[model samples]
Target chain A: GAGVSQSPSNKVTEKGKDVELRCDPISGHTALYWYRQRLGQGLEFLIYFQGNSAPDKSGLPSDRFSAERTGESVSTLTIQRTQQEDSAVYLCASSSSMNTGELFFGEGSRLTVL
Target chain B: AQSVTQLDSQVPVFEEAPVELRCNYSSSVSVYLFWYVQYPNQGLQLLLKYLSGSTLVKGINGFEAEFNKSQTSFHLRKPSVHISDTAEYFCAVMLTGGGNKLTFGTGTQLKVEL
Candidate 1:
């Protein structure tokens, strides 16, 4: 793909229901990251995956939030028992090299937990 | 650990007026600085970055930022502005030699008025 792509641009789910957001990074990108942006707030780092190394989960808000990436392609961010506070724009980004420091981002998945 | 700080929550500027958004970062080691812009209902786009070169860095939309190691600042500036420049701006830092995790600031909203 020409750029990073994200699925389910907008989602509204009842509280406690599970929701999944998908991200397909740019081809050949070796680094992938997930972030959450609440209304009028800065992006909050959720997770990071570089190559086949162990993902950096230090930024996940809680245990209920989990993300997985297969190889360096598609990734899924699952929020278990979604809560109202989980409503936000979930963004995915990729970089050709982890050290590049410049990220290409997706349009983002707007999640609304009703 | 690395952290970024956007001093102003919102900045209102008139069309054709010059604008500057302050950003400060804290890190114990050498770091790379970046500025990203987000238009309404859109994803983030890289504006510019400072990566171990001259202190001044230029980016798209006539935006520029200077890396001030002494002050730990990477403030964004533009000599003239247009309504299309209205967007939310983010400051991020990535420590060199560290894992591929980016620490982001809370963001500053730039509202360009006529």
Candidate 2:
């Protein structure tokens, strides 16, 4: 794809249900990132991946939240036992490298845990 | 740790009027600065960035920002704002030597009206 792509642009689920959001980063990009944006708050860092390995998973809010990238191409963010407070937009971004200082963003997947 | 602050939650400006969105950051090390704009129902796009060269950086849509090292501020400005420019603006900071994790501000909602 010419840009980062995210799936399930909008997802509404009941509390305690699990949800999975997918992201496909730009081709040949070596770095990928995930962030969460609450209704009226700033974006909070979630995790970062270099190639197929995750060097930084320090921002995952809880154990219920886990993410993985395969083949250095596609990534998935899964939220298990979702709570109402988990409602937010999940954003995926990709960069040519970690030091590029610029990132290409996806449209984001909006999750509404009711 | 790096942190960003956007003082104004919202800024209302008349069409063709000048506008400025303030940003401040705190970091222990040298850092890069960036401004991103999020239009309604759209993804975030990079407005501008400050790496190492000049302090003044120009971005798309006639927007510009100045990186002040002493004050640790990266204020975004526009000589004339159009109705189309109404969007949410975010300030972010990334450590120069650190990984690509971006610390973002809460964002400023610029409402350009007639």
Candidate 3:
């Protein structure tokens, strides 16, 4: 792909419903990340994947938030029993390598919990 | 631990005028600083970064920033502004020897008017 791609650009769901956000990173990129941006809030790191090593999940806010990545490619973030406070923009980004300082980001998926 | 702070939440300036967005970061070790711009309805795009060598770093769209180690700041500046430059700016820091996750500031909204 020319750039990072995210699916379901906008999502609306009732509270307690589970939502899945998908991210397809740039071709051949070796690193992928997930972040959340609440309204008027800073970008919050969620998880990171580098090659086949263990992902950095320390940033996950709660047990309800979980993410999975397939190698260095597609990544999915799932929020179970979503809360109204979970309404925010979910962003995905990728870099060529872990050491690279710059990142390429997706348009982001806006989740609106009702 | 590493953190970034964008001093101003919003800045409005007339077109052709110069503008500066202040940013300060706290880190205990070597770090990389970066500025990212997010246009309305779009993903974040890298503006510039200071990794190593030369404190002044230039980036696309005529944006530049200087890394000041003494004050632990990486403020963004532009000699001239345009209406098209209106966007949300984020300052971020990544520890060179730690995980690849970036810590981002709350962001500054730059509004350029005529």
Model number with the top TM-score: 3
Better of 1 and 3 by DockQ: 3
Q: How well does candidate 1 reproduce the true complex, by DockQ?
A: 0.79
Query: Fraction of true contacts kept, per model?
Result: 0.75, 0.78, 0.85
TM-score of candidate 2's A chain against the true A chain = 0.95
For candidate 1, chain B by itself scores a TM value of 0.98
Off by over 4 Å in 3: none
Ten-residue segment with the worst summed lDDT in candidate 1 chain A?
A95-104
Clashing pairs in 2: none
Model 1 chain B lowest lDDT segment of ten: B94-103
Chain B TM-score, one value per candidate, order as shown: 0.98, 0.99, 0.98
Please give the TM-score of chain B in predicted model 3.
0.98
User: Where is the poorest 10-residue window by lDDT in model 3 chain B?
Assistant: B93-102
lDDT of 1 at A52: 97
In candidate 2, stretches whose alpha carbon ends up further than 4 angstroms from where it belongs are: none
Model 1 agreement with the true structure over A1-114: per-residue lDDT tens digits: 599999999999999999999999999999999999998788899999999999999989999999999998999999999999999999999998644688999999999999
List TM-scores for all candidates, in order. Answer: 0.96, 0.97, 0.98
Per-residue lDDT value at A5 in model 2: 98
Interface RMSD of each: 1.1, 0.8, 0.7
